[model samples]
Target: MDSSDATPAASAPRDPAAPTALRDEADAVLRGLAGETARLREDQWRAVEALVAEHRRVLVVQRTGWGKSAVYFVATALLRARGAGPTVIVSPLLALMRNQIDSAARAGIRARTINSANIDDWDSIQAEVADGLVDVLLVSPERLNNPDFRDTVLPKLAATCGLLVVDEAHCVSDWGHDFRPDYRRLRTLLGDLPGGVPVLATTATANARVTADVAEQLGTGAENTDALVLRGSLDRESLTLGVLQLPDAAHRLAWLDAHLDELPGSGIIYTLTVAAAEEVTAYLRSRGHTVASYSGRTDDAERQAAEADLLANRVKALVATSALGMGFDKGDLGFVVHLGAPQSPIAYYQQIGRAGRAVERADVLLLPGREDEAIWRYFASLGFPPEDQVRRTLDVLASADRPLSTAALEPRVDLRRNRLELMLKVLDVDGAARRVRGGWTATGQPWRYDTERYARVAQARAHEQQAMRDYVATAGCRLEFLRRQLDDEQAVPCGRCDGCAGPRYDAAVDPGALDAARAALGRPGVEVEPRRMWPTGMTEAGVQLKGRIPADEQASTGRALGRLSDIGWGNRLRPVLAADAGDAPVTDDVFNAVVQVLASWGWERRPAGVVTMASRTHGLLIDSLGARLSEVGRLPFLGRIEYAPGAEPAPARSNSAQRLRALAGAFTVPPGLAAAVAAVDGPILLVDDRVDSGWTVTVAARLLRRAGAAEVLPLVLAVEA
Candidate 1:
């Protein structure tokens, strides 16, 4: 049952004493039959020949669509002729595994996947491997991690394994562009195999750090490994990189609409959030674009359907989060648009690589905005654990001999499970600890309390954050920076980037615009009163301006003023003179008149508050004023507005009936509420705050009109209901 006994027959060789030119012609004949000689570049062909001649593992780090896979596919044919055992390729995606298997089958080589869906076929697959019938076995990391499968099957496969190839091998390194925790265990798994198999790792994106990490992870020391770190030329002469600065969501949507028709063939629009993906997909679909959407929430069936539609050209474009692109091999994609900036250069590379798969010219569009940087910063902050927390976590783990589940460790570390999980993953990557079974354990050495471990983690996290910050702030060639980050030595200036294109702010600000805004605010109209001016939620700086009027105006005048502010007519007003100005013609008489009307209507102004309104009606009036203020805030001198001091009006509260009615009007209630209203369910009335309108009382009455209400009387400090 020995592996060599069952191995395939070695092909006949040309004479060893033959001239080099004769041997080259013989090699060309074998390559021609495989149809690889015509497809491969001269350099690529030379690299492959050298690999076969030396029988040494080769690492090819070419750009996407450079025929990297052909190098290995052709090598597989040649190596088989030389009596090499079956090639065992480890990939992270099932789709890629299947694709590779299909390609091998086209080349008349036997290939199969040993993955979750085909666990039942493992026994037969193992037999084939043992009998030396399987030429290539493509398995995912999950398959290797399967204890039962690994214990029984891998040992047999290892005995006969040759040419161990790891596709997207950057996943193995923590510092790699894309790091997977499962990939961290690959080195151990490979080391455990029989006969110390030769390893070849390939990826389109890997920097110097990633290369070094890959070398170490594959047990090929940096200096000793036969690594061909090819820096592909960044002169994608046919492709154009465009960066669009979107000032707001509306602008972004408009841009998408304008460009929807221009996009031909299959394309992808990447968004930062699932909701954004879904929303954008819906919007695009409404505008007559055949679109499919993918996000983490998309089920397996839905994902498959969308992916199929994309591949079949049923959908011309797909709106998705970053989760959709890995392992996707769509050859005809013409564009990749980022609805927002990608998280990192690594991510951008992978996403953009999805396009131009067939070597056709393509384009990548980046919609850069402040929100993009914010999202990356938020994620990076969440990824890093504080040094104190890290130290405590390590101490707790070191104290435990057996693996402790996250729930059990939570109490010990005084952190939530989600937070602890992230911290643990980071610690594992930094070599501080290892995830074992259901929990984590300290590695060989306890993390030194005073050492650079904590500093290194912090520095790494900071570096990632700074990378994102630089992307947002840099006024340089975006493509060049991206290529440089990926170690592409041939990178040249991309004339299409924002910096190369032109200055972003070419339009001059018009003073007339400010004057128009001021006139719009100051004209006879309602005014919105300001609330707390600082820390308004999620709005741009210029949205708060509006017209303001003296508080002493007639109630009808005040209402009219508030209405004007609500409709955005009075957004540019400024209070140049105080209401009590001695030189003013209207003087305190106008101010007093408005004050009296407000007080009578239960709307009062407090000395210290922005504008204290006693009721929701008055609050609504203030909201209107704030909107106008936002416009006026843009003016240099007119932006400064001071609130006049005044006495607080008595609080006019309402009964439950009034409060309930208001809530009902504001929100859509279920049919259960209608039935409860008819039944007059006398739910205990609880009032923590004052209700000014009688809407709550009216609503309760409507409910209790059918149901019995012992008493609908108000029970607050003051009642208007």
Candidate 2:
């Protein structure tokens, strides 16, 4: 949804305008949308002409800020003037839709949006559309699969729509960096469109392969003869790119604090994760710099306010994650700095494209971190599940007597809830499944795993990650490297990048700023809030518990030295807590940090004893820590909870019900441990190396409480985010 253009205009000779006066009127609308002097570029005019006069499907692959929106706005005006229906645009993000609405208003077009944020207005918006009061209607891709929208409103709109625009068309292809399953629904929508209902798909990041896939999908029938593609060079002359590598998270943050004011105008500071965004925002605010955190976790109302503040320059920068990546436009944004490298250069290009759109110059920098590859691996693990898992999901659905909601089906499957939902969506689009009122149902249609394609896609992702690493280490022009990754025909060395113009920013950090960053990051401990309720459909997994957890059986809100995702202590703790990390005695540094957490934990009553969970991977680490804590706090060291013989549970990636089913009776309260628990005076500190789902601690706590312990305080070295 980047509104910038990277490629130069197509060099093809312009066809003589059959209706010259229509062209003149379109230019007037373009001027109103942009400025009095604004006129459509050659390629932009060509797209408008094709959509208005020829009624052909067109794909435009240009860089950000090249006026892609202008093409659609101008085309909609002309088509509406000719008594065509309102344009129906499928946009990807709420921020993008909001920007499009504002842009449409400038052209005297009454544009309205139907998205998750404004459900109450949908009926009113639809009434207006029925009464012919709207010139354009913007929608998110996810809405295409909504039961009510898909069954009720979409058919009518598709029949009468004037122009169909697929914003961020690259997403329609899985080969693209930000591929989305929801976008694939466009294929069905395109096939259902009334003939001659001009379609326009626009994107700035699609490589050649993605463009081809999207263009093929845009075609009306099995044969792809009706679509026209206009691709351009992706060069952005206004951006000055650079890379800065530092030792660790603290130095990267310290550098930002030291030089944030030196950055020109209001801009963005990008972080790779939500935790890091919050961390950087807090550090910057504590240092007296104006900034706000923006991530998917931020509420919708807050996101809107943050976007407004950024546009008004109320804050110097919005420390953000990829949530702010696509389709939030500020014409004069002046800088973008990445605290950690993204896995793909195409994604990086799209994020940085937000800067330098209408400005004379913009600064773009990447402060690559050592932990970036680990973060990449974590995300990669969430991609398409194995074929056997997919088969399992299908088999469950095929055998169900009624549609099963995701919640109801979760216990029966081994996949995580989110991944399962995504797989179902893809299957729905592929005709092997359907999403109805109740939930998902099998279509009994033929389905193939397409293992070759999936494997190729995985390979592509690995290549992209390597390209990102090369971009950070390259001595050649950074702009050229990114362009080549996108297969931009006009990829060339930009004389303005650090590689071409030499380093533009210094790596030195002020000593005071470094100290403050270190202090903020070195600060330890995150509260591990106990689960208060059981997951639905526990009965399906053979676990009888339901509703609210009994208060007496619940573990008290506990603490961990740090989250594995935290940028500060996270970097230090990951090595010790990693699955392959060898078991060893407690390290002095980690032991002292746990002591600090315990010292600050203002409990109502002190813990009288310590107990360890029997760890399969970290038994030594857990035992050593438990003994050391007991010795230090002068609390008695109780025996460890032992796993029931032959009860090795599977890894806890399954839903709460599935995980609990595997662990319900998996632990035994040995006589010695039970006796020790009865002898305890107060709370017992439950020790473990790490906590993922927290069910392990919950089960063990229940066993201890049943054995006569009054309270359990769960403590861990690390917590998975």
Candidate 3:
């Protein structure tokens, strides 16, 4: 996607008074990129000249398809021609690297990438870089923290690299919509670079705050000169943006069902969660639409195949998560429809910007749902841990005799695996810890929590969320609102949006389509597979458990009416499962769904007695569910499993080992329950309000099985995804 139209490239030719030879060479490179007709935009040539002539740090902030990739590729060609080493591009995603590699090849430049997916090629790729056989080398931000690469390959590259490119530069700032801790490590590499090694940081989603932050980081080299930040208007001329607020999840799905193909051409349908992506894909496919699901949950090969299918226009759309957001280059993608609104306007703009890149007109719409806030809160809950949690992680690392992997550290710290890894990466960036060959170790360096900065960041996030709400609610131009959110001084009414020009998409859904959507979403039941093995390092966490859970002690694969993340029952279940929600019996609506799930379960053995797992929050709900099931099935009502005195409930969102440790001896079967289980001839139904970590059920099932029940089948209202 070259910046051939409405860009500085079309503004004017380079100053004739300046060196014309450099501009001519840059134009030749551009022509190779597109065709014989391709020419460098004025700013594109300016950027190349700065790197090749002035050797300056630079930040280019332009909308998607404004030819950010062109500048780097052109500079790379010129630099290699003048006896410079390979350009090292710190990209954020593998898809972006793949796209850039293909784009570079068009300009007759050699490119190679090193990431987790291609470990086998690393040695050969590094050798090529060392031999000056590669013009460009792309690596993910996470690669910078890799022990072997950081210790060996990085230092060598820093000393010899001609130009360093930081793509998706917004990730460098916590103020940015997508802040990645690993990107912060570029400071170390920047400081170690040999003098006069130019650097480039480019992003389309950064606001004034993020741009300033990235520029400051880019100029940290030995010269310490200020980076030239060239931020342009973010308005996309070809996009017609609008918001079509739907009453509920079903209505939104119905709208997509009715209007997906009528928009423009083959495009992407963005969902906020993996479950939503899959759900939307299934619903659209059921309605005879050709589409596939793409998310982090998708396997690498499948994701590649889906991407290829979309590029070739073999499918109408690919329902996706933010996994498809940055660096996906389909020049003629006709539309981008979000199933729900993102929490930030900057992120929303970046996503919708994927459309109309090369086309004269493209539709960009948002089908905001009532469930978006719940999803937002779910993600916001994963922010940086409290100060005490950070100190606990540091103390554990400092005391370890040998480096401990994230898995080993999981049991010692209270954090979940993903969050713990994120915190560890942040610590690595702050110099309080270092990732070594084995895992991570404390540097014993003093580190402050920076409470005020963190608080400010949190406050900024809240403001962004409000801005998104305003973008949805405003009667003003959609594109103008987005541009203003990015601090574009040129923001104004585009005269092309639904707001400025009037509604382009009807809110009405076809009656038949709405019915189909309702039926699809109304369908219930998701399998809740029982825990089969204990987490590693359980013994270190003071639990003797380890290895595969004995089959006889394991609970049979159970069932939940639906996932809390599901677009269907999730809306219904969220309110009931909320922390502030009062304890009560399961609603008739939910109970009927539970009955439908059980009637369709088709368990191998039907004989069962009902049992309840004591819930501190919803004991009444659990007891009622068990009693109703017992009465409905005509099975015995076995007594509840009581928590051992003084054993507090396990914390929410704890890792497997920590959860298991908390539950190991926390439950005991009363004498009556033991006798009843001994007399029971079939499996027992262990009831609970919901399941998060699943250890509570595992422990309770083990206790019941030990008391002589033939099997234990767990049932719950909702399962956390």
Candidate 4:
């Protein structure tokens, strides 16, 4: 939506230099925006006055639904009234940008957003902003580092931009729960702005350290000044907090399925992982609940549609991941149910704040799972790689004669594409690399990898995690516990929490619903889609392969009993494949599960021989699985692909080009394996303990295909999601 239709016609702008005049106009804007008679709270007035009166940087650390948007919308009108340039707000999510745009329109501030969601409209929005018609412009943090935007649009915006607002500002801190390298680029924008331009940063979730870090970063280049920090209690008085410890995922699903209709109003149901969100959404839909799944993996159109559905109360609840966090406005949301605990109490508080915003009381339920800690650790593992990896990445970029794309640099570095891109953005923010037309070019500048700083951040994250664990088990008031975690000095025992009120809700799941949920979770077999195209720049990695993988060389669609994220088999196999897990023969339970998977697989041709990839630690398990499958099917048990002694197989790489390069010549068919494959004269069942990158399976299947196996069918116990 453009600003022209969203806003009201201007009625002669008001004076901004007078604080009293600004206050009167601000209250009018707030009343219009909130859709009721209202006056600004003392803290909000302080923020507005600081921005309009003194033109200083301000950081507002208040809970959600605290009218933080009103302060900015009002400030934008006042600032623009005095002929200042449009307010530039860097939001962290598309859903949030959309909500803010609607909110700004309510206040008669002409607002428009330029994000990945609306690429075709960006030129129009930019044109409108240039013509001084748009009063406020919203963009995602990632846009700040986009190659074209940084080189072309950013300089123009910085030169003419009036007020800067960083929403979800906690992401600026490395220690924050939602730390993103893209948000850190704001320092450059803050530094480039003229001294008198007001800047505001707002967030609902941040501890003292994160608050200080954000405030310090808000006024980055101003040596002698600090941002005006406005901190408020994070307690949500309208929320009735409680926790329900479910025995298993199925039980939790059953509870939701049974009680969803009983919930007061349309709200949100949160899951820890995308898989769980999808799974829960599918199950609830099967039970005839009008729900939608929202996660990072959801398409842009679908995410927008889901948000609209929830806003209009079309769906019962949106089963979502943290992708639904921050800036999702629902004034009368009835409840928020988290299927699993977030890694930090601050994050949990922020998510639940979405509910009960305009209502008297909304239910906030936490269903702690047995697998929550595992999920937390899985995400924690994705933090910044070691100093050596960063140095190596920079060194590779520095030595390149021309700008190199991430695909070309993949083989030279071991980091995954996502992590590598994050590092590149961080380097770009630090001025150590520049994203030019070709791709990325390293600046010939010395950059120190902050070992100690990252270590401290990691330590802080650990403390947050422990705090979340303690939150679930705390005997004190849940509301007070969360507030205390945010360092709210006014935190006290809230009589509305479960602990204080002595369990105000029931924890029971209907017997029939529980049975149905069990049946749903028990049903196994996940389709493992094969890799169709080869990774780009494989030739640069010393593999002669490039371009589309020959159809004959590609592995066919395969099957795994379950994903590593599944609620059913995931819990059982997680320990089996864990880093410290002991290697042993497949248990009867896993073997039976695999047998069921194969029975229902309905492959065009049955496996005539069993082949196993030479395993590093799970050799015993793989051998037993292959041997047992061969015996059961009465097929030949072909020998395993041999790993040359002392030759390291690709060490579980995330980058495809690097993985393919590392797997080159790492596996070879044994003396009799080719003869066995030819004799079988049909599909070969390639057994493995697990499949992650699917590179190992690809390489092994390619070898068997060339060795005369008619077809290759990969069967694994678990597949990493």
TM-score of each: 0.61, 0.97, 0.97, 0.95
Q: Please list the residue runs of candidate 2 whose C-alpha ends up more than 4 Å from where it truly belongs after superposition.
A: 1-15, 222-224
Arranged by lDDT, best first: 2, 3, 4, 1
For all candidates in order, the CA lDDT equals 0.53, 0.89, 0.89, 0.85
Clash count, one per candidate: 30, 15, 2, 0
For residues 176-231, write the lDDT of model 4, one tens digit per residue.
88999999889888888876888889899888888877877876865436677777
CA deviation > 4 Å runs, candidate 1: 1-37, 115-133, 142-146, 149-155, 193-196, 220-228, 384-454, 457-461, 464-476, 494-721
| Selected candidate, larger TM-score, 2 vs 4 | 2
Deviation of model 3 at 418, angstroms:
1.9
RMSD values, in order shown = 16.0, 2.5, 2.7, 4.9
Q: What's the lDDT of the predicted structure labeled candidate 3?
A: 0.89
Q: Which residue window of length 10 is worst by lDDT in model 3?
A: 3-12
For residues 1-721, could you state the per-residue lDDT of candidate 2 as single tens digits?
A: 1212423222234455547787788899999898899877767887898789878888998889988899999999999999999999999878878888888888799999999889999999999999999999999898999889999999989889999999999999999999899998888888888877899999999988998898878885423354677888888999999999999999999999999999989999999889889988998999999999999899999999999999999999999999999878998999999999999999999999999999889999999998899899988988888999899889999999999999888878887877888899999999999999999999999999989998999999999999999999999999999999999867899999999999999999889889989999988888998888887888867888788888888899999999888899889989998777888998999999999999999999999999999978889999999999999999999989999999976555676667877888889989999999999799999999888888889988889988999999999998887
Model 3, span 43-77: residue lDDT tens: 77778877888787888999998888899998988
**Residue-wise C-alpha lDDT for candidate 1, range 64-127, written one tens digit per residue:** 6666566666666666767878888888876566566766776667887787657779889878
Query: Who wins the lDDT comparison?
Result: 2
Clashes of 3: 2
